[model samples]
Target: MTTLRIGIIGVGGIAQTRHIPAFLELRDQCTIMALSDVNIERARETAEKYRIPHVFENYHDLFSKVDAVCICTPNKFHAEISIAALEAGVHVLCEKPMALNVAEGEAMLSASIKADKVLAIGYHYRFMKEAQAAKKAMQDIGTPLVTRVQALRRRKVPGWGVFTNKDLQGGGSLIDYGCHLLDLALWLTGNQKPISITGSTYNRLSKTPNQINIWGEYDHDTFDVDDHVTAYIKFENGASMLFETSWAANIKDDQEHVSISGTNGGLSVFPFELYTAKNGMLLNSEAAWLPGNEDFGLSQAQNFVDACLGNAELIVQPHEALQVSQIIEAIYENDKS
Candidate 1:
């Protein structure tokens, strides 16, 4: 395998925690050549810690040195960075919400195709073993009856970062948390086209602006984003999805779940259980899942590396990612109108 030199942009928490570590795991196939962030000190620190050979105070500098980049910046910068990197002939594995809106995402897509480069999104849950197990169980259902998903967290607003700022991150819990389950559902259902979306967002919890927070405290008065969201989508294939997510909510379950109903079988994940009728009897089974899929960042990095070598196909293509952005934008519009 030719060593595919790599670079990382926006070396924030996600970059240090996931992307760098994933690249480290694929040392034989890739090298972490450069790191960049507007915060030069932090970028230098991350480069030192990760042992990447070079550090850039700006992303454009990193683009000149690496074959690909992992975009871990805020939603607003995603398109600009990905398009810039692609035009520079570098491949990209961008974080989800591919871009802030459909049009920007389309531009990102156009750049990727125009440059003839690999552009993949970090929809890591698709590779989760439980998710894979759920997809496999769908064979008997013939067609999906319903997709029930909840990606909830109780009073855990990430108030410390740009997450609470609507301008930088775009929207709140729906775009941040709910987008995961939404993408997972669409992927499992074979990404059948979507007909329309209806959704709503509420700022009920942190609206007071000076409110105390579980993750960190921020000016409550300036807390300008949703803390909770719910979306109802109808797929063209007749599969309907009901999604609920929150950074703060009055709910009991604080984790994630995707319960699917099919004609011959039903499956519930995040607990990895499968149910079906066989031999005139009902059967229940659960797969023993480990934390293997916990390395989605690494898996994505490896995928980009493999695609560079023509050894594998991209798991999340740019066009499919653009569709995800379209639905996301539609849901946001549905919430307001």
Candidate 2:
């Protein structure tokens, strides 16, 4: 039982809430050796709170002290830090959206290959019980024809952190919340090759003052990113997908859904249901008891550790994660056109 030494970069909300806790849960296999953040005070406080051994304001300094690093930085910095860590012979577990664009993702991938170290993306949604069950059930539904995805939140724009900053976070709802479902849908569908994408994004809600934001309140004057986005994607296999996501909408409640229609059956993720016609009657079946209480973040953490130790294959490879970024880039590019 070799305990892998791990460092954490960017001690932000995601690091504090998910990455730190998840790594702590795998104490038998890994230890939080150090932590780094642009905010030295925050890094020192987080290290003290979590009992981390070391703290550094520069991520580069922390890399030399740890065998692996978990990057929870803003999208713009993900590529630079990940590439450096990988080049330094350390495994990397980068938080989602992989990078701001496909080019940066490719660089990270290249560095991982050159370093011969594991590079895993933090698309923890794939570890969910419902998502796992849905993937297995896809065997019953042969040849998916279409995918429909929606991740909508009503008046829940995250008012904290750099989420509203386009420079730091890249985009808003689509890249922040929607990327999880997008990655999940692509993974569940076997990482289909996207042929084309058409998209439109809006920031009308974020620009409107006096809006009820459950997360908190942000500066409407500086809210320049998209709060809503819709897109249509066509895959190389002739399969098509329709996607819609938002941080705020005029809806009664938040909705998260992913459903695929195949030749034999159709399935939806949220409620975990299967629909098909048996004989002559239409039938809808729901999973009786799909385990839902397990900590996916912990599971993801363990997977990264195992992969780094050569005990298991990475469930979310960098190349697969790159496809998600490519589609996202395509969507934004299309919107610009």
Candidate 3:
């Protein structure tokens, strides 16, 4: 078994909390070979903490030391770093939203194709135990008619990182927090082509003075991204979706829900429920026990490593992730139009 050598770009919170630890846990399959960040000191400190061998301030310099790279950088850098890695003949596992928009995503996809290397997006929700179960249960639902996705957090706007920076992360709740469930819903529904999208975005709550927020505090005057977003989409296959996501809603609690109604039956993802009309009766089934790794980040890392070594297929393909970017871009564009 050839162990894959993996490098991590951007030694930030996501890298330390998710990517680095997950890859470290799979030592038998892959090794964390190198680390890089704009903050070279932080990268060196993270490398020392993880006992990783090589460290570089430039991601390009670090690419030569590893067979694959996990990009945990901001949305602005995802495309540039990914294209560079792919062109360098190294596999890439980029953090979600694929890119800031569809154009950059297409370039990343093209580079991967030209390089003949793997390009996987970090739609880690797909690796969740319940999400895995829901993928298989999708077969029972038949052709989907309508899908509903709600990724809401009540007054929990992130006060750390560049999450509020429109230029760095592209958008707020929709791109950062909501993209996970959106990607999962699209993947479960077979990546149907979106025909039309109608969306509305709001940041009035986030921009208000002295707002009550659960996640620290931020400058209300500089809050430029959307805190709440709602969209309705129509797919080419006659299916439609009602999507709503927020970072600062007046809702009761944080909710992450995805439910699909289909021609045959219906299913919900968060709790892994199945709704079917069986034997002339309406029934809802919930799994008392589910299989697969409970830690989705670990599962995602393992899958990326396996795919890099040609041992398994990527659950989040680049194009499917691009479709997600397409939908997100349309939503934002609709707001402007």
Number of the top-ranking candidate, with TM-score as the measure: 3
TM-score of 3: 0.98
- For residues 122-172, could you state the per-residue lDDT of candidate 3 as single tens digits? 999999888888999999988999999999999989999999999999999
Per-model TM-score versus the true fold: 0.95, 0.97, 0.98
**What TM-score does model 1 achieve against the real structure?**
0.95
TM-score of 2: 0.97
Q: Encode model 2's per-residue lDDT on 100-152: one tens digit a residue.
A: 98899999999999999999999999998889889999998889999999999
The lDDT leader among the candidates is 3
Give residue 17's lDDT in candidate 1 (0 to 100).
Answer: 82
| Counted clashes in each candidate structure | 4, 0, 0
What is candidate 3's local distance difference test score? Answer: 0.94
User: For each candidate, what is the lDDT?
Assistant: 0.84, 0.92, 0.94
Candidate with better lDDT, 1 vs 3? 3
Arrange candidates, best lDDT first.
3, 2, 1
